[model samples]
Target: MKKRSLLFPALLCASLTTPSYAMLNGCVDTTDADKKTAVYFANGILTSPYAAENMAFKMGIAYKNQFKNLHEDSSYEFSDAYNYSQGKLTDIAQVLQQKMDEEGVAGISGYQIYELISSGLNNDPIRAVLAAFLSTTTNAIYTDALLEELGELMTSASVEAIADSLMVNSEHIGLYEANLIAGKRVLIMPHSQGNLFTNNAVAAVKTRQPDWADSIDYFGIANPAALTVGGAGYVTADDDRVIGILSLMENVLASNLDNDPSALPSFFGGDSRSNTNHLIVEDYWDARLASRAVIDTNMLRLAQNTPFPLQIAGTGAIRASLSWGGQPDVDLHAYEPNGRHVYYRSKTGDDGILDVDDTSGFGPENYTVACESVNAGTYQIGVNYFRGNATETAKVTVFLGDGRTITPRELMLNQAEGSYGNDNPATMFEITVTDDGEGNAIYSVQ
Candidate 1:
């Protein structure tokens, strides 16, 4: 066979679909990925929805740049979605500015700011903590009835509601059911308000699938929690004066993370001002002038020691697996573009393989994409009824890695319809892959 042209040279295709965010063919294969990548969640805040996410994403880019500087950045991929607490910045800045105007910056005290916040909350410091919690959680869980139930004490009802705000969060559920449940190794990098979210996400994983707990790595920045919900290491800048105020109260922030040798003293009375000492990008993630370098270094170390999933389907660039409603038998099949067929007889294909073949009930029999590679091509994914309950519904979950999302399709296998065997498998879906001429894979699903 002659060599295929590298997708360079500005290739043109008249019939091409607009690069769909909804693309990808998931080939099922075996093994762990050598090219390790972690999901760095950087989300938008209420005021500037993209700002916090950008700041959070900067941490990864900063770390990646450091790795690039040392020539060790060949194998990692970066991604984002994180919410920010910039409103705290506004509050802190306003308070600190007022204090500095009354007395010089040197006269400002964290305890003073804490007093102002406490006074605003009717002298209940616990109300300040609850206010902080409500700031981030308002979008998720909020009700007038709940508000009426509030008091100076952080009571059992408030704790339960806060837990509901965290554990029942949609984003947290997505991370668990999608990536972690699929068996991927991930480092959930969350900063500031995001640390609270990540901590709760870690707890949900531990409760549901403790076996996968070690596979999930975490690194926190500017945590405002009393302590980490997960035992992962975290960091905060030395002169992050907003937290300086919160540190005076044990229930509000993780004061222990405030010690950063690299962080400089604040230029202002308090370091909570945006684009300055309190920001995640400027104060925490930057390498040459901040503690975030140490934070990133330790996270990388933690990821290095973090064990890979002992289970299959937990690792992949793309994946497809079978789970059925009723009895003990359903089969997943993938037809890779290179004419390689992946099924029971030939488990391994040129691109991916069938690593799991279950004859038991409610199986997560998975076909993970071969580590580090999801070849360019069309994949026809289908399923067959091998034995047992014929009236069962079979589900095929396609985890499209590389910035793609997960899609699960189900088909009711009526045994009377004769939908069993090699050639007669039900076609769950199809995915097409092509190069976008810039070394990036463009995927589309049918």
Candidate 2:
């Protein structure tokens, strides 16, 4: 297609004076647009609420613009790009590819709303053009959520058709499990619905392939509201294979939809079910707690291998996995006044892992940690498995605890689990940090 004719740069100068924040689409308009590309509000057929839709459009626009700017001479024209040279279009595609290489992650759930918006565009030629430009390698979990939400937007028959397709296709992750597994990969869908869906998906998978069920990894929810009684019910009814992660913030800030002024029920609405999978709902807790456990001043340590001291802090103690071999025993070390000190170690039975039945409140298990106070220096925490202390299987953390704050640096996992942490285990560290800190530690998934 020929690139659309470009208006003079002077004529293209148009501004959109609006504030932009994270919306359901994960994009927003912070400034104005060019004459060719107007920065106007797009309701996106009202699938998401106006606030959410507006947010998504703005975010999408921002993402597109960001990608464009990274390319050479990425100026916009009022008309489409068909009028431009093949060279220009190729450049645009290359730029998008570079972006995916840099920013696109394998497992993350924040883009759920964005994925839904992209799926919506799948039906629209213009929208599809933009989405294709942005997506180079798609995360299967995220893509599935968007697809399912889009299916719901389609006729009722369409939703049932998709469900039936999932029920029959043994190869595909069951709709329930696929969604939950996606949650495990991406931490953005951190809600009860996401968690419930993950758990249900696991159950569904077990029914078909019990052997693989153990292999399934669980990613935690980025949002705490996803695990509430209501949120759990919604996701369970919608998709029970996935599990949601809960944080102190959710336990503290989550309010009844009827009473909270800031609460947006529409944002929380989803498939509702009374019965739910009984696998376990501690992925989020584990994600948060594992990170939290690192924060204990006593748990801090410096790896013996590293040259520079790495400071590590976590959000909370991670809920232990039943699949986990046993409670991890760790050796804590720090630079005390004179010589290297063995501050504290994971007690024999006092394995640091929180049990599945622990209360969701902020208590012993919430941000549990075992730290060794060195005089004041750098250190690392090395975790050793049962009697096999031959070599450190995993270096769980490296940190410095000086009686002021507890910070853990590393987390070594035995194997990847579904809904275990947000898409990125590294990013999930933030959730661990915020769970105990003051302020708006929690965010909503678009």
Candidate 3:
């Protein structure tokens, strides 16, 4: 697939007005006093030095408000990047504004300034003025030189440095202190192109500090990364322009769609393939809040090496998968109507079997009961923290034999009272079974 033209030309020329102060201020109100950290990477259009800062500030505000709504007490410490080339261009804007004033080009918008520069490049007299200013400031011969450097910085080595610096910075170091003192975690958030940059940065970090890999979590929004699957959660909107473009590029590269390129819609497209790891939302803001919820709910699980649980309900079978994050050794307990209890000790009963028993780390302990083996009575499904820490969130998903899936239910364990051999495990969902005409059991949620 052909790469789209660089978007910086339009973004750089579009606006110069500073973002609103409300959008650039850090959020103060939070639920938790022991603050966590967030390292954010701005989108591709944030070519200006202050753009990342502005984006981060706005995100901080959104997070604060959203977390407050969710009643989460914890707060985030934000870190971001400043584009050096964009900084130089912002400095040169002052000179360009003075020249515009001398030429009596009053009320010229930001785009008009770039237009003047583009036009001046061909006229000797105008070029002389720009050249003089460039020599005094950036030591560049022409406008193209600055653009080329900016493109290089955005597309090459500096991109990785931008991602790496987030981890090695004072905020990251502070994470260690906070973790030791207050048991806090770090969340790495990147939007759009920053997602790609973050993917590379994480790869680099794994090579450098292999041990710190489990200490951080990643939440990518509007991501363009092609092979994003492990160790991160991704959220993308159906109407996001960047996601649309990326979807187009992906289709083109894979040749999965029709060859007629003209048939493709310009915007508001959908991803060709559904990624289980990526959550699809309505828009950018939705993606942000959804990713935040995932992070907030699974912060303890994400900091450990536990794979996100996968639940699939097969025809003619009822399955229940119990999973949790953190160091809790959670167990799945299914009570059948025939007085048989299926658990780790008694893996199989007449109705079903506890197929997998995970005793450590992130668990996807599974219980499967054949529809034919089920009796016509109510079945109870619950989870027990057999060992380890008790105060962890447990996810229970019930799959009916009719190919319908119950929404995964989450239960917070009472850390104080939870322990092994606790028969009174928290009930997550109840399943009732009745015999269809031919002795085949049918299932329904009770």
Candidate 4:
């Protein structure tokens, strides 16, 4: 239970922090395969996909403001990518609890966490379905009746988190490929769990395109990893509670943290007493000038290393981005005209893959047609209300890479209809394309 008590504050910082990027709320003064690309791969412990999205913009604004002050050229394409969604209080704790249960290692838990999870269970519908799917995926037995039982036990249980890590890291890697292939310089700064995602993505991308290394970079803020995946180094508070606690656990991968007796509290404001130091915006962001300087330094180096103007890898040849909230599970599906179907069940089809899926809530499950994989034909994209019925408002953004990246189709699903996204999904969008007479396919979203 000591772990439970210790975990509550860090958990509180994760789940309770609203979508404000600290003090830089300025009317946020305002991309492509060729624009200088900057992105924020956020930690998954957010309230919704929108929260993650907004946080990305806030981060961009904060950075842009600082970058302008530091260097003359402050133009860059900036966007946000949501980590796998765990929008509810219970969702995040469940992950933490499961980590401990599986590894039999103790770090974050106790009476306080018990209180948090107890209060969150009734409100969280996503984990039950998730448990059923995960359990069944592993050849275990999980009936509808068993879900309730498993749900209770899961407060103290955990699945092999490799699936979660894979889903998020792949999403990040996809962004890198999408942008870098588009001839854009990429800079991604990940916070907390995002450091892991960014690091993995960078390593993976570097492995694929070593010569492109100089074109991409990352800076970990409150970095939990001792090593920077494949980007610039990281800056972390000496007494960061989350980092401190994770460092002590064998099962948890985290950065080494050491407190300096004479270090000023203003620049690195991690407070063990208040337990409020885990938040990036409040703890670091631009508020901590010294650390902010570190981030800008990395940005400057990226500029020097990469001589491309800021560009956004927005909307690939065929991109389907789905986001929803207030429900446990809503799955995204893409039907390729090549007779290949992609969903959680069939995640990869042809060159299109469902790289990111959110069963926790506030999704952003995305399906992308690989950089050079656009076949001329009709592609159907849609969403299935997989579980929970709390009046889910699901939105889908289809980027045609032609001119319609902003066309969003929104749906209000009030019932949990299908367990698996069928050949023909309920909510849908259609994209039509024609191949060049010379054997190249050009597509557009209508």
Q: What is the lDDT of residue 177 in candidate 2?
A: 27
| lDDT per residue as tens, model 2, 1-446 | 11111221111131122222211111112121221111111111112234433433433443345433533432221101011112332322322222232233343222332344445544444334334423344423347568555434432332232333222222122222222221211111113222333433334454543323333333222222223221222112112222112122123123222211222333554212223221212321121222223211111111111111111112122211111112333222211112121222212112122211111110111112222111111111222122222222222211112111112222344433323221112211211111113222222110
Q: Candidate 3, residue 198: CA error in Å?
A: 15
Q: Give all candidate RMSDs, comma-separated.
A: 14.0, 25.4, 25.1, 17.1
Cα lDDT for residue 7, candidate 4 = 23
lDDT of each: 0.54, 0.24, 0.47, 0.56
- As for lDDT, the candidate ahead, 1 or 3, is 1
Top lDDT: which candidate number?
Answer: 4
Q: Write the per-residue lDDT of candidate 3 for residues 1-446, one digit (tens) a residue.
A: 11122222222233243121111111112132433434444344324547666666765665655543332344444545322233433423322332333233335432343454445333434334434433343443337666555533333332233333323332222222222122334455665555554554455433432334454456676666554425476655444444554454232111111111122343534323233323222233333233445534543334243221122212125667776655648887876655566778888766678876777645557777654445666567877766664467666666566645465666666552445444556677778776665555566785
Candidate 3, superposed: residue stretches over 4 Å from native = 1-316, 416-421
- Given candidate 1, what's the lDDT at residue 57? 58
Residue-level lDDT for 365 in candidate 2: 16
Candidate 4 residue spans exceeding 4 A from truth: 1-35, 65-75, 87-157, 160-162, 251-274, 286-289, 307-429, 432-446
Question: Distance (Å) between predicted and true CA of 33, model 1?
Answer: 5.8
| Displacement of the residue 308 alpha carbon in candidate 4, Å | 4.6
Q: Cα lDDT for residue 409, model 4?
A: 53
Arrange candidates by TM-score, descending.
1, 4, 3, 2
